[model samples]
Target chain A: MSDSTPSTPRGSADPFVPAELYTQVQQFYARQMGLLDDGFPDAWADTFTEDAVFQEASRLDEPLRGRDAIRDSSRARKKRLEAEEIDFRHWLGMLDVRPQADGSLHARSYALAMRTRRGGELDIFASVVCHDRLVSVEGAWQVAERDLHHDGSGRD
Target chain B: MSDSTPSTPRGSADPFVPAELYTQVQQFYARQMGLLDDGFPDAWADTFTEDAVFQEASRLDEPLRGRDAIRDSSRARKKRLEAEEIDFRHWLGMLDVRPQADGSLHARSYALAMRTRRGGELDIFASVVCHDRLVSVEGAWQVAERDLHHDGSGRD
Candidate 1:
């Protein structure tokens, strides 16, 4: 109905490749990944949806929600992360995005993330599950609900 | 096309549902979830194609080819994990599984996992993408190629 993509893909006005969605999502993450690795924690939070709820380590908090909250939270996170040392590299793959009945999307991506602090890079494997509400806002699809799946083997 | 759902689902033989294949594949996983949780890792891996590839981690390895390798690796992993002093929960969600062009079913699942170790649970989320090759072997459907994605956040 929203012309996001076809129910059956293959034939549609929208570019309907699940892999491509990951590529677009990757672009959205560039801002945060760079900042997080550099200790600019707050800046990394800027990439979240205004009403975004970040679920991490069993502590689900609206660290930033609504347009106003996002701006303020970004600034705070950036300042806090400047002190902690971290080198995080994320290898996101095996991306799958499907169109839902309500015109929204349910996407799942595989991650092989490695974090380095002093010397060695410890591999951390995780599955990031997201339920995204996509809308044609200003001709681009932005995030809606990023329901993360903190499910997986910690060892990579 | 084949139906891979168990008889319990709403429309098991809708013609549009692909019943035979659906029942076989669906039941197999219906069995997998329980067995894997019950600690029969190798037996669980036996449901895959001989050239099966299961990459628990996103890496240069791409896909973990061969059923024997997948079985051995899964067994080894279970051995290591069962010995850890950690609270580990493996959750696999079924999103949708489609019968592919080659009759193989490509399934996408949303995964949310948490591991509590040393008084803290680092919430690691991942999106598991499975491309399964289903076959009517001895009256059942088995998996073939599974490409699990383990890194990056696929937000809206």
Candidate 2:
């Protein structure tokens, strides 16, 4: 909330972005993941651009192209988890943010999917490295591409 | 490493600190926790002020006082974990940063300790919310006090 305006000049392309931009990117992920965990699949998908591509290299044969495709997959996953009485919290950390030459941002982070079953135990559902291409749309950050690399899958 | 310089004027503590200060606080925790996880207990302890106090409300009857005490405890724990061939990775997220009237920073974050046994399984060792009072010492951030609230303990 501390002034999300782009303070850096266009085409700066710094190895690391400004601290304000870094904090903003973290907040953006927090909101996006919170939306997904709260069962708002459409809202979560809306954080992505219309033609965003999401790929899990370890499992997916091809990327899920487009926001609609992402939304459908998220909804189906949420429904299955709900039926199984499982709750998931996606935690992100160790973020690396850098400015791109085209006024976009490159973000990479470690993603942990912590799963808990109602009246049951808590466990790790997935551990992956997320690489994202972020662009601004209407002054809000949106994911244009996301590639996930699962741990120990030799995908990297 | 965007300038760690305090840009905000003194005695102007808002509900939240500036975004640059927020990101710097995150970086501080990243380095502090990384040192502990990387088997540098003494180095990790050095991140705290000499008179720092650390307390776990749910478990510790009395808080650990002084950097020496913290270092001793951390070294002992590290030895035990190494003997058992266990590796831990501390992941922190959802950080809340606010400025204090005393020019210090109040930072709170969700900390996840993920444990992995050599050639064995990976699991969550602990989940806690860490509340810290961070002070700048010689232009470097250090923990002055830390209070940990473990999940399901209801100490909060």
Candidate 3:
């Protein structure tokens, strides 16, 4: 998400979207693609708050917390897919955003990600939904938080 | 990635990080974990700009554009995953945000995801990156655009 400063009511009326802001968001997400796809553990660490309460818990598993811990997890996961250097391609569509009373906003986006390995017959895909928060920082808009949703539920 | 606004500064006087901005970022990323684990897509759409761009590209590839198109991509992906009623879990972590000129931001994050099938060693883990933009909408922050990086290039 584009991380930037908040505008006063006196600014753009009707809560219209600005091209500049969209550009910023594009850039931010682009960088994230780099960190995740490039297998850069340290890069992911720069995405959240220092004391961020990062936990990815499943319905049947415990949660993973903290930036450093998350980095380790990312490294491990990347290593597994590193064989033949499989590439994960995400196709996100169907998004809707709404404003909140507390000046916070919420958004839901639908995504389809495909992972294709080099010279392989496997090209796996998954469906996902994303939830996130945006907060103004240092005069820019940035992703204050983010979460991912995998569609449909059934036991393994 | 969160595309909503939380209160923070444009730049921090401190060398690396600032206190308020740090906490806001933490809250933002943590907020996402809760939303996705719960699988709430309806609320997720409200986080974006009305005229937003959603893309899926390599950090090095040309970006796909627009919210409506992104939606189509999402639907296609969801159908594919829901097959056989598998339960998928998205592991989101390793967030990094960088301030930019024009009051925007670029960020990097990592995800380790898996699915539980009817019977098997579950599914493969996923590694993904995202690009997002932020803008001031109605005096608050909201996502202007979002891009998906799945090529595993990490070329930001």
Per-candidate chain B TM? 0.66, 0.87, 0.60
Which should have the higher TM-score, number 2 or number 3? Answer: 2
lDDT of 2: 0.80
Poorest 10 consecutive residues of model 2 chain A by lDDT? A1-10
Rank order (by TM-score, best first): 2, 1, 3
Q: After superposition, how far is residue B114 of candidate 1 from its true place, in Å?
A: 12
List candidate 1 segments past 4 Å from native: A1-19, A26-32, A35-46, A61-63, A88-91, A111-115, A118-136, A149-156, B1-47, B50-156
User: How do the residues A1-156 of candidate 3 rate in per-residue lDDT, one tens digit apiece?
Assistant: 111212121112224233344334445555765677777767766664444444322331544555666667778878888865887655443333445566544544555667777876655455556665655556644445556645443321
Tens digit of per-residue lDDT, candidate 3, span B1-156? 145545665543525444444333433443343333333332334445656776655432554354444445444444454555555555544555665677755544665556655434346555677655666466555566666666455553
Among these predictions, the greatest lDDT belongs to 2
Q: Kindly report the docking quality category of candidate 1.
A: incorrect
Stretches of model 3 off by over 4 angstroms after superposition: A1-16, A53-60, A99-105, A139-142, A154-156, B1-156
Candidate with better DockQ, 1 vs 2? 2
Model 2 Cα lDDT, one tens digit per residue, A1-156: 012323232322223446978878989999999999999999999999999999998679989999999999999989999999989999888786767789998887778878899999988756666889999999999999999966545313
Per-model TM-score on C-alpha atoms: 0.43, 0.58, 0.42
User: Which lDDT tens digits does candidate 2 get at residues B25-127?
Assistant: 7766665675776567777788899999999998789999999999999888887877777666778888888777898988889988776665556677689
DockQ of each: 0.03, 0.14, 0.05
